[model samples]
Target: MTTTANTSHNIVFLDRDSLIANVRRPAFSHSWTEYGATAASEAAGRLAGASIAITNKVPLRADTLAQLPDLKMIAVAATGTDIIDLAACKERGIVVSNIRDYAYASLPEHTFALILALRRNLLAYRADVQAGQWQKSDKFCLFDYPITDLAGSKLGLLGYGALGHAVARLGRAFGMDILVHKRTPVEEEGIRSVSWDELLETSDVLSLHAPLNEQTRNIIGSTELARMKRSALLINTARGGLVDEAALAAALTTGIIAGAGFDVLVKEPPPEDNVLLNLHLPNFILTPHIAWASTQAMQILADQLVDNVEAFVANKPVNVVG
Candidate 1:
């Protein structure tokens, strides 16, 4: 518990506009400067005399970390710390803290929004109405595409952490049974832990909440897609690298699975050549990563961010990351 001997620590927030929350000033006296965005080339220079750094997506590589001897702590505004070099930060004696569980409610609500929209064929029907299907309909309503209900369906959840549990609670309210996938094939009492093969094969709705790492990257590939029920819906509010973009597009086009609702992609602002962007399928719903950007969640994250910095400076840091 090494308290910051200095009363005024120079703080620089690399990306402020990225979050839409009302960030309150820290309790103790400090010099604060913020920028809308910080490019890689500008990171070192912007952090030249800063002792505390705040960032959301800006990458601080080993080379850049080495240049800032004055930097003592990094307050990450998001849960994922992959953008920061943890090894380098540890070696340099820099304390790293990250926001967590701030999206527990926002993410689950967004997940259900996607599920309800896709399951009820909202997009497909809207397109039909816009294309003049109702005016020319021989009947009262259009039933060209199948519509499904969430009740009595099986929801297979991967990585049952805070987010996953929140989703499960919502699924149960919709009269759906929850099947948690066993990453290690262990059977837990009271909770049904299903095999990966079973989860992929039988689920009516498969939701992902896993983190992206070596073991989880490309976890849902062509082979996995082929095993799913043709009526099942795949929802990924997690990392985009967890699924193969090409395979997902093919799956939706060929009816390998019913639909997919995603809030993330392998690349943000994906290049022109990205396959998912060109699909233009109603069954494939894509959002611009707003699953965790609700006003409430952003405020919670912002509050925690300032708390992390204040605690660290007081020598009782919370949410310290390795």
Candidate 2:
């Protein structure tokens, strides 16, 4: 653990509006300053005199950290720490902690929501209904969109952590077979362990639950997408960079696979030129990275964020990551 010389600390929350829950002050002698949002240029200025920094999506790169000599610790408001430079923090003796297992319920539910929506062609059918296609139909029902059942279909999970386990349980409830490819060995019953190639080729629905990192970034590119079944559905509730945005846009346009549902994008608040943003396919669903932002889940995350901060101040930091 990195120890600070100061008796009291200055804590600054860089992006307070990212979280929708109440963040109670830490149980220590510290000054707290919060901003609704922080841009890249404003980061160094906001965190100038701070000993501790709280951030959700704001980037704390090597250059920004170099300016904040007083920074002793970084309390990440979310699980993903890619926004902060871990190597830089390690070299500076800055303790970096992140929230863990906070989105177990909301994440899995959202993943399945995407899966079910794509499988049943819910969005396509909804658009048809809104366009009065159902009203103009001669038959009792409209079958313009092909609907598939989740039962007996294979559910492939990329990373089998707490979130993966929760998703597998839901798949089972929906009568879907579970197949997983994870770094660790599979020890759970009824879950079949498969190679990366087999998982890609076999699953009816391939869901990503892995964190964004060097090895996992752009893991699902053109070749990986081509390996999947033409009827397969791609679901990504995890990080956006896991799939190449241009490649995904091409795949969706070319019909390499059936469809996709994503809660994240490579660049959040994506620019006008983003390929995925320009795609107007009914099969492709792009949610604004709110898979883990349910009211219940945000409160859990908010409570845990304070816990991480409190633990670090007491010299017993939990969820301490790179």
Candidate 3:
């Protein structure tokens, strides 16, 4: 939390348009600059002379950090800190803080929106209706797609943090039996702690809520997909790197698993050639990383973001990540 003596802090926000919420200024004296969007090549130049930088998705790597000797703090506008090089920050004595637990309601609700849509074949049926199958049917309703109930199904959860707990509660509300995979033993009441293999093989609906890191990237790939029941559904509102995109495309195309709903990708604004983007399967759903973008959630994040900056100015930084 060190700063130049009696100087106004120079704060710059890169990619300000990534958030739709109103960001209030920190309480202390400071100067602020913001851009609607920023690219990797332009990061260092834009952050030049900036002591405090706010970013949502623009990466701040070791090479970039090397150029900013005056930088004291990085306030990540989101929960994930993978975009920030923690090792480099620590080495440079830079404090990093991130927003946390602000999306508890929005994220879990979005997770179930995917689950219910996939389980009940809502998209498939809607497609059928658009294709005139319902009107051309011999019966009152078309039965071209399979519909399943979540009431008695097993809901598997990976990573049981705040968002995970919220998702688990929703699963219980739907009368699903909850199964969690944790590195350590799970002692929570009415929740079954299972091995990773067991979770993959037994869950009728698998939801990922883990962070993306060296140990978690591509946790669900070809082998894991092949082990799942052909009727099971996969939901990921967490990190995109948690699942292998190429493997997921193949699995959905070949019917290895019933369906999948994802809100993230390893690369945001995915490339034109990304396999998942090319898949036109009705069972697969992809959102533009908006599970955490509900109006209320965005405001909560914005408020907390200012809180982090203000706390650091007071030398009592809250939610310091690294």
lDDT leader: 3
Model 1: per-residue Cα lDDT at residue 192: 70
lDDT of 2 by residue, 68-186 (tens): 99999999999899999999999999999999898999999999999888888998999999999999999999989889999999999999989999999999999999999988769
Model 3 has an lDDT value of 0.93
For residues 1-322, write the lDDT of model 1, one tens digit per residue.
0123345898889988789988887898888888888887899999998999999989999999999999999999998888899999999999999998899899999999999999998998999999999999999999998888899999999888889888988998899988898566535433478989999998999999998887999999999999999999999998989999999999999999999999989988688888988889989899988999988999999999999999999999999998
lDDT of 3 by residue, 120-207 (tens): 8999899889989999989999878888899999999999999999999999999999999988877998799999999999999999
Sort by lDDT, best first: what order?
3, 2, 1
On lDDT, the stronger of 1 and 3 is 3
Clashing pairs in 2: none
- Candidate 3: the clashing residue pairs are none
Q: Model 1, 47: alpha-carbon shift in Å?
A: 0.8
Off by over 4 Å in 3: 1-7
Q: Provide the global lDDT of candidate 2 against the true structure.
A: 0.92
| Model 2 regions lying over 4 Å from their true place | 1-7
Error of 3 at 210 (Å): 0.5
137 Cα displacement, candidate 2 (Å): 1.9
Model 3, position 178, has a per-residue lDDT of: 97
